[model samples]
Target: MLGSMAIRALSLSPLDSIAVVVHPDDPLDWLPALGNSAFSASPSAWPSIQVVTCTEASQGMSFSIRCGLKALIDDNPKLDAVVVVLADQPFITTGMIAELIGYLSERPELDYVATATDVGGEGEQNAILMPPAILSRSMFEVLLQLEGDAGARKLFGLPQFRGAALLAADRTTVFDVDTPADMVLATKQILGQTYIREHRF
Candidate 1:
């Protein structure tokens, strides 16, 4: 998942860092130990990661969000913005992340830039804001207030985030990977597109 997420900052700058917030007992055992850990020590590959254990993760998504943001803040006091992309959304592309960053950078008046897919039944559709969002430093404190099971998108509708913007993303690019069946379908989607691209040459 991390391999697919190395996106350059806006202006083609180096993608500085990434901090993965894992539960203390999460199965991804290879994560390194080098943050303000809430758990004991244990020690990865490209981009060089530092795992931040969210002991209060069970409390809600807010805790995890706060934990991850705190780690980033501690590391880079001058952080411009942050892109909160979920690991399950492996199909998220670098171009998508860059757009979020670039758009937010261009509009300092905005609190965040978010991606949304058209979701609806039958032939109707509506833009439903989702993650893989880029939020300016101004929005970090608001994110800390998110509650149980609430995602970062929760704050998008609030009065404080009035100037937030949304970018439409293709549905397939945000295909969620929550189940084995979903993984199978995502693999087929990737491979099918690869096959088509290769033969088109």
Candidate 2:
């Protein structure tokens, strides 16, 4: 999943850099493998690619997010914004990423741009506010305040960030793989197979 996500991210023409964050207890040597594979597959993208390791991954998702954001900022201080992409979201495409960046670029007044889905009468919900989303440098402080399992979505509730949020035109791009069933669904979607509904216990 990580490898596929990395390849797709690196393939984007709008992005100048890519960061892959790995947890300390990832079991596999994903960092080196990802680096090697990326270099082998796309030598030009390799230099811009960075593998970040989060020693405090056990601390939760916020730690990993902090680690990756810090690494990207440190690597390129001139960067105007950072796009947070999760490895588990295989369905995310280069076009979606570019769309986020392009939307933010066209609207300098916005602080952040994220993908959202309309949940029927429930109104719209932030699909993930991630990977395919863009966060300006001004929001770094707010992002750093996140902790535990919390994510950037927490900012959505804050008054200061509410009005600045811009939703992407496409909502389906936010789908991600969070469980075995999700992986199956993703595979089925990718292969154009008909979904087989199953009851869960």
Q: Pick the candidate with the highest TM-score.
A: 2
lDDT of 1: 0.68
Q: Write the per-residue lDDT of candidate 2 for residues 27-117, one digit (tens) a residue.
A: 6544455445433345555437766889997778899899988898898887788887767776676677777778888888777887666
Tens digits of per-residue lDDT for model 1 on 154-191?
Answer: 88778867444454556777777878899899778878
Angstrom error of the Cα, residue 182, model 2: value is 1.2
Cα RMSD for predicted model 1: 7.3
Q: Model 2, 152: alpha-carbon shift in Å?
A: 0.8
Report, for all candidates in order, the number of backbone clashes. 0, 2
**lDDT values, one for every candidate:** 0.68, 0.68
